[model samples]
Target: MALLQLVLVLCAWWRPSAPAALPAHAINGTSPAASATVSDSRVRQERSVLTNYGGSVGLSPYFADLQGRPSPTPPTLTTELTPPPPKCMDEETCNPLARYRTISGRCNNLQSPHHGTPGQAMHTLLPQRYDSPAVFRMRAVGGGLLPNPRHVSLLMSLAPEGAKVEGNSLFVQMGQFIDHDFSITTTVREMTPGGKSVEVDCTACSSWYNPACAPIPVPLNDPYQPPHLPTGERRCLPMTRSVGYLVKDSQGRPVLSQPNFNTAFLDVSPVYGSNRCTAEDLRLHRDGMLESDENHLLTKRPADDFPLCFTEAGYCLHSGDKRVNENVGLTSIPHWSDERLYQEARRINIAQFQNFVYGEYVPLLLGYHTAAKMQLMPNHEGYFLGYDPTIDPGVYNEFSTAAFRMGHSQVPKYITFMNDKYEVTYHIPLHYAFFNNTMLALGNVFDPLVRGLLGVSMRPTDLKLVDSLGNKLFMEKGDPHSGRDLFALNVARGRDHGLAPYVEYLKMCGVKEEVSSFADLESLMRPESLALLARAYEDVRDIDLFSGGLAEVPLPGSLIGDRFWFESPAAGFTHAQLQSIRRVTLASVICGVLDQRNPRIPVHALQTPHPQSNPERRCSELLTVDLELWRETPHSPSPPCTHQGQSYQEGALVPVSPCLACVCQPGGKMRCQCDLSGCKQTQAAEDCYCRRICGYSTPHLKPQYRQ
Candidate 1:
């Protein structure tokens, strides 16, 4: 009887809906009194109306699509596939596709045109009936990649319009810049030379379909297909490149940078070699720029310069996908509101992108000491991560889906299009900022800051909280919001990809603490968020990846939480690749592209037209990459090492992979520790653990502190 009473008392205290006192260490770091103040503000922020509008976890009734597909089929328990055979891959009995007698997940891979084919011309995407979400989630049921999906509609709410954002709007624009490079989906779209498009049916793609899809695939439906390609061949992957031919830098060495793209970091084509169709398409795809005037420098395609569709139906606008499209407009078009001004604005924005990336974002993301150590500066052999013959960069799903999506929280509500006086000429809400083509047509406002031409300057987004738009994106004229919910889909997608839950990733990423229960999340999330999480899911282990990640507070000195620093080479992204990406900032790209021209832009100041922080200094001062270093060649023009061709000098401070140390041994030959350790479990485990602990990057990263 006494034990039962004790159990009842514990249960009372564990009531998730009832507010409980926060743990003593919940608000770590600050002094006790100060912590209390922070806690109150957080609680107030949690209870704000912004948290009320959108549903969390599962789809809200109002969030139903125009077609009546609701999110999440309740907090339903999942059914696991049959037990694996001794070797499922080899055994016909346990083969995932065996039951349905289908093999390739061809039709199953293409979901609805929810987000649509983002970077393509208007009228892109497969037929709704044939390649809908219903078909793909059928592929969802039987696979090792499948993890149980959790409905998290209870976590969302509308954001307060125009809250105090973190950085200026320029940073928000930068997110768009990188987003354009990385957000390409796995689904393909095929178009004919006559601009006719067809949805490729799966009759030829594979013999099996666990989802039991019909054979309705179309010919020439390749999204990445090259123009006039022979039939039966699949399109190559899209790469990040601007001009087909390489432009010479100051030293006559070739530097690859696209004129339309602000940052060349996102290689769209020939540079990466896989995205050939996108490259061919960017070369106007025969949809040549309306006129090939000087503004058409490297690219003359109408769809080349920032493709954002602005029509109501979002059908045949000059661009496609209105929200991200119009958002691109705030910066690319407004300031240079005339077609004639397009080239000049493009020049300045490109320069600014270069300046800001190298000078600020890189350092802000990877500590300055880290970038400097990597020797990321531009030079001939050292330029563009050096001409590596063996650098094949693959997109890691985790980086693509989760860590990179951090930009969504950075978008602000209303952007201030600056007038001649550097004051607001007008304010436009995010949803309404569609393609005002008249505003984008080049004859009107030329100067970015002119009265007729508005230079839209944006403030930063809330760092702690993700905007609801991040999860539930915009759609044209719908009540319950007919389009896709990025965050919700992200959670489900993460599960579909067979990703580990929130806590498991933390341990793998080497987070300092253990996460046994939801309460232990106090180190990361707010008490209110934790309580809400507890109410939404029966088990703490059931919390979805994004849900748990969304609840985390930004780590000190960083905008991202600990969950974002996932370092899994199995995902196909090398640690070296992460280091390489961190090194090529905006400044590096600008420096690589222009050679000697000063950007006339601010240093690390993303909020453009808002007064340069150091107006007196020239762009030269902001540049860390040196072009002259690349003037001389190495033993070979092509790098033998498989990396981004980073230039290194003694004491230049490059990242050291402790697990792959090349110590000199017997006859002047150097060997890596990993190679010497062989495949022994104990030694391999040590090397893996050491590499995982190689903490130059990440918020909760463990310090290797190796010189």
Candidate 2:
């Protein structure tokens, strides 16, 4: 009955519910209830009635009698009645983190690949069935270790000169490019019987049995809805939640995973998936040297597997990836004329995408020595170093909700683009990146002036003084309201994700010294930063991972702080595979994009000699690819691959990121293990024994004691 009442409320969100035979409820203007009822002309009148009458509580006079009087505040809510869960005693009878503690990582997983199936699942890619959530001594809030906005804030304090220091925006773009994979979630929208839309606010829906996950008629709101679509009609923006597959897995299977998207490569699917459409449009000619402006796309040609963007037609034309499909706003940027704007950006963006992970980002973040052992570098590709069919490939709770979020600090306050003499240009606030198509059409960030600081060498936008434009995330057209408290949210999200506190990760990461109170962080972080953390949280154990990590300065050369670096290769990766990932740089990805002669794209701009020497060069000119090689050749497969009927792009150059490494068990059959440990046979290695020595333990987990 309670479940039915919940459904009834959800139904009311679309329209007022009536008996099955009523078909059209004056209460909700023709809602199908659970049925797929379409909206009709009555929607507008109904909305008007709703607007003029009672906010959400309003109903037409015709149904006022049917609507029950407000049930007086349902008695103090019985003090949450749900019993305080059993404590985390010896893993055998512990609860899932969400139930055991606060509402964190429990519901954070991507909506399962089986989304829209009989039941939508949102389980962890790396599920630790045994539970003992991280314990916190103080109630956690968003900005654990930073100065409270009540006193001093980072963005408000950033000076003009400090804000202007440029980093390799290429890596920044790459970070966003890859972020699309890890941070994807769709706004679930519900149609009003009157054709109006209501964003579903699922805060009231409990995580374990969230009615929000139910086909409940609640629409989820998103920041990118208004502009991504060519039609400009608001579309539900579901970021691609697909496990990234480079090629076939170690088991020779099509490396599949859950809550993921169709795109398995590192192409610019954020805007274009190399998907092109129409003949007489500029398709890369097969001669490895010209354009096929008039010919039809081949059935199994490279265009089929790695399609070019029909950016000339418009940004919305033929984006192959699903993300563009979600946010049509990404398509249709007015600047995409002569295809120069979108196409040129693509060339540089993709080169950087491959380059960042392959050439510098990975090695710097993971540490060169560690990366080499994991075989994450391009040179390790042939030795069976980086493929494991069993790896979850799902983003981690700590990584996603907290650790990786450190990038927020690096966001700049402004973005600059060039037109002429650097004279015909626009230097706009970075938040304008989210501005309307007209402003974005003016070429906001595709220039070469903003290229070095985003690399490893430049300082992270100090956590205390993060850029306002990028951090606020959602701003109304030109509104300057720095709305969302991102750091506070990151801190909150970690708790929501049920991630352990900084100390737990520290212990597991093999930090021999103790971090008992917030004061202990003083040695590793800015004293001011520690003071800020002390203000928000009462106990040191209460410090959230993201806040704590951000507050601490990174290792001598690493991009992320020590916790994220240690947590990055969690038990899921093999040593060789980790090596390969560590060795990965933007260069490897650039090299693999072609089967022909390469372009002079520098994998890392900072690494290239005297980048300041060519500050005036266009991003397109600095990074390059042989467009001619991408042209479809006469000798190319006429009908494409045997599986062309599937409509899924089958082959394209995908630089490997870390993936699972599975080996044949004693039975000589393949078995999938999601442990982040390298090879288990070698028991004495550092990562293998580090957890136990540090006092964290999981029975089945060999490498990390935190199973």
Task: Please give the CA lDDT of all the candidate structures.
Answer: 0.31, 0.33
Q: Candidate 1, which ten residues in sequence have the lowest lDDT sum?
A: 561-570
Candidate 1 CA-lDDT value: 0.31
* Per-residue C-alpha lDDT of model 2 across residues 1-707, encoded as one tens digit per residue: 01011111111111111122222223224422231211334222322221121223221111111123331111111112111221221223223222111111111112222111111122332321111111111123332221222111222222222222224444454454466533443333445687654444332212212212211111211121121124432222111111221123344432211222212334333333211222112233321111311211111122222222211212221212111121122233333343333343343333334435555556655566666777664443222233333433344445655666766666544443323232223233433333122221222222223222222223354554333332344444443332334554454334333456676677777663677777666667766667656644456775556666776766554555100111122112223323433443444333322223333334454332235532333233432332322222235422322222332111211111112323221212222333333334344243433333423354344444333
**Model 2 — TM-score against the truth?**
0.46
Model 1's TM-score against the true structure? 0.44
Which one is best on TM-score? 2
Which prediction has the highest lDDT against the true structure?
Answer: 2
- Candidate 2, residue 680: the lDDT equals 45
Candidate 1 residue runs with Cα over 4 Å from true position: 1-154, 158-166, 187-274, 284-359, 366-392, 434-438, 442-472, 478-484, 561-601, 607-707
Scanning candidate 2 in windows of ten residues, the lowest lDDT window is 1-10
